[model samples]
Target: MENFRPTKRSKLELAAPVSHKNEQFWILDGNTVLEVGGVLFKLHRSRLVDQSIFFSHLLDERNVQMDGVVVKSDENGIVYHLSNTTPKDLEALLQLDKNPMAYYLVPPPFPVLAAIIRAATALRFDTYRAFAVKHLENAWSSSVTDLTTERKSNAVEVVVLARTCGINSVLKRAFYEMVRVAGYGLGDGEFDADNGERPQEISRADERRLERMREHLISAWLQVAVRVDRTFICPNQPKEPTAGTESRSSTLPKCPSLYSKRDAWERRVHDSGLYAEYKFDPFCGLQALIDIKWDEDEGWCSDCVHAKREVWRTMRQRTWERIEVWMGLDK
Candidate 1:
């Protein structure tokens, strides 16, 4: 008889099945098994889990051999086990996929904005506002030309919060540009912070982005306003750039007088000290002034002093409540 070879082999004949039932177990190459219930798996391509279940066993720096394929668990729940591949471990396994510098240059995902906003609010830092502005600005810039449903909703939220928190004029313009680009119609609905809908027309991705931005702005605004005079950017001179060689130049240029036609009128406000008035008349009704179609009948009339006072009073009350919460006085 001629020599015969079997193409199919039974599981028992091929190799022992790796059991992960009661004890922790990992099988490599469908043949090599490593168990770590109490016993640790020591391999050139393996790593032990850390004590804290929060994060996975960090890869050892010196023992990392790039030549051979190696994999480790990221206990962060950021990654999963099974080929042990997951989105969370993406940062660690990044070296295997691309250059390190390339990964660093990429902007973090939208979800990171939420965490950043939370941290900034907790720290009572205005720097978070700037970051929130930057992210919104970038989101607007990216989505403007695209005009997808997701982009429009994000743009709207950015516009609303950037205007409300008074982040910066530059960022404010970016948010506005996004609205114009996306062709979103405001309709009968108003942009009132307390009353506006969750923006159903928006994508879940953009909605999450806006939520983070709003959280940062509102939290930071409340914290700073209650603890310090947030009306002024800084105690001394808010206009002076904090970091730079050219902070306080005596010859700093002044803005072009709005009443340039009447230099005498300019001199009058300057002489009367009205020019130094803490509240700016131009910024009065900024919400209404910026939006041409906005209806002042929406109870935001510029001439209503009583209404303005009531608004301020309500804002102060909310401010106190936030401060109490932050200081743990409420608890």
Candidate 2:
């Protein structure tokens, strides 16, 4: 076999025609048409260029001419082909250009929010990216207990999104939520299917940082456990009967067993259920332990309760100091 000639395909087979649809915030009146994922969107070129530096350069007349963009011109405007982006994502990014108040007033669903973040970040829309970040932070910042099942499920996505977009403000809380909902073995897929699946998205460096944080947290929890263990106050001893007045001139009331009481208290404080609660309630920390009251029937003395509370305060302060450091948010 010497030189061989390949058969050419028809234009229709080579490139299928895209169907245009009028979507939210983009219509026929728009100056530019963009075909994304087989769907066409009519939007203003100036609005996009103004919002994203990527678009500003990408759509520049010189670049467009040199790159020989696949475009079609009609009475409406010029159409450009955009590859590798879905129509939903492009719509989400364009929605940002509408009334700013609407974004906050009518919050989108988590899927829509994720799409907005992904598109904004990819297109280098700084303002839109920040807007997406604020919405994400607000959506999840409420009490974790109040989060719906769906919202709880999205915590891992939030962490990946925050890290990928360089939104440090949300990264700490997002990471904490992920660990709370997913546990130390986040890479095991305990929380979400996609969690830890995309190393390119989260990065090996970030994964290592998370592992270090887990180690620090384990150490902190052990410290808390130790503090809880040593919090019991030793009973006061009755003054030894003077040299030899009488072996027992006055009988002393019998004291409750300190060892047994201490054991019970430790069990309550260190229960796995309570520890799980602490993971989600980061702000509460050891305060949750202090809030626990001993049953009157259990015969727990006020002195021991007070001692436990004091120990909890100390533990909380220490743990708080380590939180920022472990989360890599100290800066």
Instruction: Score every model by TM-score.
Output: 0.21, 0.67
Using lDDT, give the best candidate's number: 2
Clashes of 2: 0
Task: Report the lDDT tens digits of candidate 2 across residue range 1-331.
Answer: 7898899989988797657675565565677777777777777789889988767977888864424236667654677766645677878777666756666777888778888888888777888778777888787663333333232556556777776666666666555555544453345534334443343236567667677766665566655643345444434324556876664425543434666565655677555466655544433556666667753434466655666678667766665556677766778
Best by TM-score: 2
User: Model 1, 140-252: lDDT tens per residue?
Assistant: 55322232223234445444444444433333333333323313333334554443544424344433443443343345334422221223221122265676556654544
Q: Which parts of model 2 have CA positions greater than 4 angstroms off?
A: 1-26, 49-77, 83-85, 140-151, 181-201, 226-228, 231-257, 270-285, 295-307, 327-331
lDDT of model 2 at position 178 = 55
